[model samples]
Target chain A: MIRSLHIAAKDLKAEFRTKQMLNSMVIFSLLVIVIFSVSFGDLLGDSETVSQLAPGVLWIAFTFAGMLGLSRSFASELENGCLEGLKLCPVDRSAIYTGKAISNVVIMFLVELITIPLFAVMFNYNIQGLLGLVVVIVLGTIGFISVGTLLSALTVNTGTRELLLPILLLPIIIPVIIPAVLATGKILVNGDISDISGELRLLLVYDIIFFVIAQLVFEYAIGD
Target chain B: MSTNSQKINILSILTAIVMFIAAYMIFFYLPQMRDTSGQLLDSSFKIFYFHLPIAITSYLAFFVVFVASILYLKKGTHNWDVLARSAAEVGSIFALLVLVTGSIWAKATWGWYWVWEPRLTTSLALFLVYLAYLMMRQAIEEPEKRARLSAVFGIVGFASVPLSFLSIRMWRSAHPLMFGPSAQGSSGGLEGTSLQFTLIVNFIAFFLLFATILAYKVKNENLQEEINAKKQALP
Candidate 1:
């Protein structure tokens, strides 16, 4: 755990210095939000329905952005040949997996936080649901990043990883996406934890399940 | 060569006969669901016979992949790798068939091409999972690494099936009864004697068909391996 934290801290310091993954995800998310606002502008007469659709739209943007961040999480390591250096260390492989996953989640969380307000302003929506949206985003991001981290490791060594990462990652993440999207929509509407308890519980379940599975399989994935 | 030719001929003949019988049962033998006025709406409902069997066989195909993958990881044998690949290919083919037939049936029953319903969505997810598996297998060039990576993926992919099914079912509330009769998706869908018999026969026929296809696929892979070995020996 300590070693994992060191790895996470290392990645965090590097990410803060460069912010390559961070920049693209933020810009990509804003693009998605703008596109969605344009697409839905003509359909709905009132802002109420559009506001309600915010959660779904927000998630779609976050997911697309998250995909790029996940793929790039290991790309740096691959390019710099750092994975071999890490593998040569007397450390459990899963520590590296967990470390990368945590960094991905943090980076994704920052992206989501920035996107929410812009998303609200662009769509003419209220920020009363901002806190709830944050919670949903946190839970959803952790679940997705956990799976994405392992998959990035799996495909990072493969050819055309840009294509392989999303192809393999998306289908497995469907179970996570369904519950998270449903829960987010509910939370945005009611702005309370009690009402969306089912979605919340399902999201937690999905997060834990995928997180543990990633840990167990991380060895087989990158084991030489 | 003569024995091999004769074996192929027998398997091909058996598969053809069983396929025809299945087709016949679907069209002529199965009892159609009775309408509100007790009239038979028999023709298009026949797709259910083929539809459900193919779905079951697709699941069976994945089951083979799961077992073979486990064996490959355990024994590190080339045979298990080949079997896993064959099963995955056949499985993806059936999964695609299930989607096409399902879409056709959905069009007939729901008056729409697709819905966010549980079973339909779940089957779509399953199809995508196996498609990804195939793509993963192709992405890697090294045979050993490819086999190991895909074996690991095959295991996790199969495990996701139930989670995908449950999450979608719970999230969507209800769209349809999943796998029941066309209009009345409530009860066991197999209402009458003929309907039951036809479903059973078709299932048996599909099992036979699955076996035949898998056998041929594995045989082809083995033959390809022999040819490669012979070329290597020539040098």
Candidate 2:
């Protein structure tokens, strides 16, 4: 675990130095929100409908942005043979997977932090139960990144790296997306924890299941 | 080669015989279904026999892929990888048939070709996941690398099936539940022994059909591998 943390720290250090992926992810998510706001401008007048549509739109931005970040997570490693260096390190192979997943989750959270408020302002809506909403987003992001990171490593070596990631990742993540969207919608509307217990449970289960599976299979994915 | 051909011929002949029996039972041996008010239902309801069996067979195919994938990863054997690929291809085809037959049944019963129901959505997700699996295989050139990466994907992709299966039970689903306890009641289940027997016959038929096709696919993959070996040897 500590080794994984070290790897995570190294990735963060590199990511912070360049800020290229972070910047693009944040801007791309914001643009998704902007475009959504523009297309649904008329519906914004009706806060009722906008609240109904908000969760799906919000998740779309997060996932699309998350995809961008994930596809690049390993693509960066291709430079200077960094992935090979990481593989040669004195640690378990799963450590690399855990570290990459953690970094991907952090980057996704950062992007979500910027995107959420902009989304609220653009749609002129108030968010209730901020903490619950945060929990939902966090679990959802973890679930997405767990699978996304592994698939990113897998696809980075493929001929159509960018195009293949979403195709490969999206269908697998449907279970995550469904529960997260439902929980987000409930939290947005009522802010009631009791109401969304089911969605929360589903998201928690999905996060754990995929994370462990990804850890077990990460070796095969990145193995030479 | 003779033994392989003989085995395939026997399997195909058995599949043909069982399928004919199943078709006969479905069309002649069974009575038409009726509504709660004693009104005769549309003949389209017959598709349920085919639809249910195909869906179950496809699920069975994916299960094979899942097990074969884990074995391939564990043993690092070429045969397990071939089995996984063949099962996935067959599973993809069966999954597509589930969607197509399902849509036809839905249009006849619900007066719509499709709805975003949990069962339908999850089935589509299942199909797309395998489709992506196949596409990923095509994207890679190296046989060993392709096998390893796709084995990992095969395991990951199988995770969706259980979740999708549970979604119908977890949520308010419009899709009919034929067995076990269902939220919408057990009205959709088979009623008489004849109905149940026909369903059983169809199940057996489809399972045999799946086995036959899978065997053929596995043989084809092995042959392709041999050709590739020969080409490499020539160079």
lDDT per model vs. reference: 0.82, 0.92
For residue A113, what is the lDDT in candidate 1?
79
For residues A115-146, could you state the per-residue lDDT of candidate 1 as single tens digits?
Answer: 98898787776656566666777888888898
DockQ-based class of model 1:
medium
Candidate 1 matches the true fold with a TM-score of: 0.89
Fnat score for model 1: 0.58
Model 2 residue runs over 4 Å out of place are: B183-187
Clashes of 2: 0
Cα lDDT of model 2 by residue, A1-224, tens digit: 99999999999999999999999999999999999999998899997898889899999999999999999899989989999999999999999999888888888888999999999899887888998999999999999999999999999888889989999999999889988998898898889788888889888998999999999999989976
For model 1, the superposed segments whose C-alpha errors exceed 4 Å read A39-45, A48-53, A128-132, B1-13, B35-39, B167-175, B178-189
Clashing pairs in 2: none
